[model samples]
Target: MVLQQRREPYPHWEYTDPSGAEVLRVVPERGGLVTGWSSLGRDWLYFDAERFADPDLSVRGGIPVLFPICGGLPDGRLPLPQGVFTLAQHGFARDRAWELSALEGGDGVRLTLAHDPHTLAAFPFLFRLSLEYRLAPGQLGITAQVANAGEDPMPFSFGLHPYWAVDDLSAVRLEGLPAEGFDHHTMAPATLAAQLEALGEGVDLLAHPAGPVRLRGVAGGAAVTLEPDAPLDLVVLWTDPPRPMVCLEPWTAPRGALISGDRRLLVDPGGCCSLSCRYRVDRGWG
Candidate 1:
């Protein structure tokens, strides 16, 4: 299994197993995004080729890295000891480019990004972020590490937003979530039973205990399993009506953590923290 470099619409790395049972592509130039993953020639990731072509538009699909802050801030402003800084939804890491640091055998690749002057102006912290993507026979593992390089402690949140390909949003069912969660739009109370019963257009839950979340009843008799190393504080379930895709997000904190201070990660100076999650596909599920 050798890693192949390709230059087309953008620069990317591709890996294919010897048996041709799996293939994965990563775009280091686009925030180290995993653009595609396929098993048995079946794509498991939802990506918009048109949106990806536009350099200005943030790619709507794939696994987008959410760091420093997982969701939106109150009024898009973060209050710090120094002052108030304007931070956008999901932070700035996804909008910036990440450097490809390592390629492990044919199964893994590592990308790293650090704070620069532009990042400091908004985040006011010195930190290094590393993301590693590894592929197995039937699983894809994502590991993220954030190192605080500043003298002061760093406050942040992190998450992964993956758009999964589904045949029908109405036919999907998610299990292993907490009995209750919170709504993203209204911040209203929500429950696992109600979500399953209603199957609403969109829903968001916060602070779920760490465990394996499973999605079953996908089109073509497939299923997806997500297992995180630690319990995530937030879980987001959303999809657009009439679209054959849904996003199951895992977050360290809920939206507006910068103001609520709820589940925010505080890394001490010279210290680091890490989190990881694995996605497995079951092709024979019925």
Candidate 2:
């Protein structure tokens, strides 16, 4: 799928699978929406908000989660990183335009975004983000491949922010996680020894009777459940003040800055970090 840009403002590009079965519109001004996923009946699922209303979450949908490189510099009160001059929020991957590299596969579409000297100045690493949005028989697979093209090893964290629609948050029951791993984002590692133990046997989210998970209309509202394979260590469920969407973020990094304070990575100009996951939705009875 290739979109011809005409310098128009709202929608910068558009993508359609070979059969034209699914279409995604990229709007620079409106936050890219996987606008049409008929395979799943257009039930809003996926997250990237233009602006995170909660002071807690700084990233919105379709935004490349970046770091050295975490959301808006600590406390919205610091100069840009040394040797950097770009005006992007956290990293340059999200703000800069992404080119559609390829979409001719058996499953879905693949998009690529790369960084150069200019982007390195901000995040200090030569990297390529290849995002693949693949739609298979009954699931939507999302994969992010981060390759380090710089000479030095890079140390960073990453995650995905997808907003899914739900009937209500309170009525939704999240399964497959520890009942007590809900510590404050700022909790120190040392202070969590006890708390971590208190969280009885980790919840096995992948054990739903149907197979992995089950998202149904609970108590008159909708619910979402993710039964991810082993690598996804944390799952964050979020919803804005009055929005109808819920964000089920699977992360390799926490929301805030790294507390242990260690930043060292060796890329040798060709290292990479890749994360992949998928979600299947079966909206029960509208």
Candidate 3:
């Protein structure tokens, strides 16, 4: 459907049906943040225009896509140009307007974002990124693929940030993860890695793993499953102390300064990087 831009409390473009079910929201020229649904939620999502607005802040369990890296930078400075690679935190893709190339049939909607000379100043590569959100009978599948369109190879990383609401935080349970995992605090890199190694597959409260992997509330319960390939090795769960929302973040790599020796992924010509996950909700689990 041809979506129209909406300007009000916040500058955004919305696409929906006659019944007012929201499909998508594109915020261009500000942060290139898209808040809405390609399939799931079908209600609301959040993207920030100001990176510095919360340089040390991030939301809980909703899909927030991180292109280059995740988490805050030391000294609160964006780790590009001055760091090893020039790409900004989370890269430049999230800061550009993606063209809706296709939204038809059962294939789903395809949003494409490309890089030019300006972006190359930070990333230094010609590339195209496509995000596909496909909806089927009872599931929402998300696929993020990147292609190197430049003559040379490209290096990058990506993450998914989806904020999910449970009947209540106290009632939600996360499964398949250990009771203790790794902690990636800025001041204690060695300690974090050691803790990660110690816990192995255990859930680290620092990483926020809630057992049972199910959300429960007075209304009902919902489930989330993450199946990422070799590239993605970490999952993060975040939530506000009293809010009903939770964010599930899957990452290809950890987010940190370029020199930290972990924030890097190289994509050769025609190379691609992708991460996928599924979300489903059921009633009466509370």
Candidate 4:
């Protein structure tokens, strides 16, 4: 493995395989975001560097870490036993900076996020989040560890929103997802297939695959299969067409799970919870 620093365009850590067939670039200050990834002679991630240049905008591409909560709360308020806290959509981990370090005696990188004043103000808990990222010939794997450093058990949800590049949105198809799901567009239950067919508009729905999900592009394009670990197997499908991209997000719980107490995961005090997921890529229509 070869690790180098690239300053142009932006400051990020670039790691590559000796074979030079795989590459990954990450920006720690940007929520430990994976800005770009390439394998099998093709770029798998869709990154909007133009928008990324502006600091005020939320990242439109790359893999954004969702933590503490999967989605927004009622009026951005989380009524915990401690008190009522204002937690934004997807929590604050994705917006705050993270510390990045090379894996010790390993072949990848590790990014760590600890509790800060801002986070405590929102979630009111001391926690540590460590993410280890690695790459192979045609795959990317991530292992996430969340530790509750406080004296009380912490209730939270975790997820990863990865924007994948494609040749054509209309030509993309995903297998292994449930046939029905809640559509965020209309805020109603709808068929998953029909939601995906609206290429001109967009899609934002959570599908409970409860396992792995496979996505394929047009002929001669890219194919990706996402296999998430238990408690994080649900997939959120999203796309804003005309950009040739789609986001297959793996989530630990459905939106509003924290308040609804539906499938919400908890970490005991002084205990850590570990989860993992993998993405395998290739070239093919199906």
In each prediction, how many residue pairs overlap at the backbone (N, C-alpha, C within less than 3 A)?
Answer: 2, 17, 35, 0
Candidate 4 lDDT, 191-213, residue by residue in tens:
98797788548989987885678
Candidate 2: how large is its RMSD? Answer: 7.3
Per-prediction TM-score to the true structure, in the order listed:
0.91, 0.67, 0.68, 0.96
The candidate that wins on TM-score is: 4
Q: Which of candidates 2 and 3 is the stronger one according to lDDT?
A: 3
Global lDDT of each model? 0.79, 0.48, 0.53, 0.86
Superior candidate under TM-score, 3 versus 4: 4
Once fitted onto the true fold, the runs of candidate 1 whose alpha carbons sit more than 4 angstroms away are 7-11, 17-20, 197-200, 207-210, 231-233
Candidate 1 versus the native: TM-score?
A: 0.91
Candidate 1, clashing residue pairs?
Answer: 207-233, 210-231
- Candidate 4 TM-score, true structure as reference: 0.96
Between candidates 1 and 2, the one scoring higher on TM-score is: 1
Query: Residues 1-286, candidate 2, lDDT per residue (tens digit)?
Result: 4444434323345555556555454543222224334443353453443353332554444323443333434443323234423333444454455555445664566666677666665566677777777764346777777788777665555555565555654444444444334433333232223432322322111111222444454222444455454333355444453554445556554433333232222235687766676776555533
The best candidate in terms of lDDT: 4
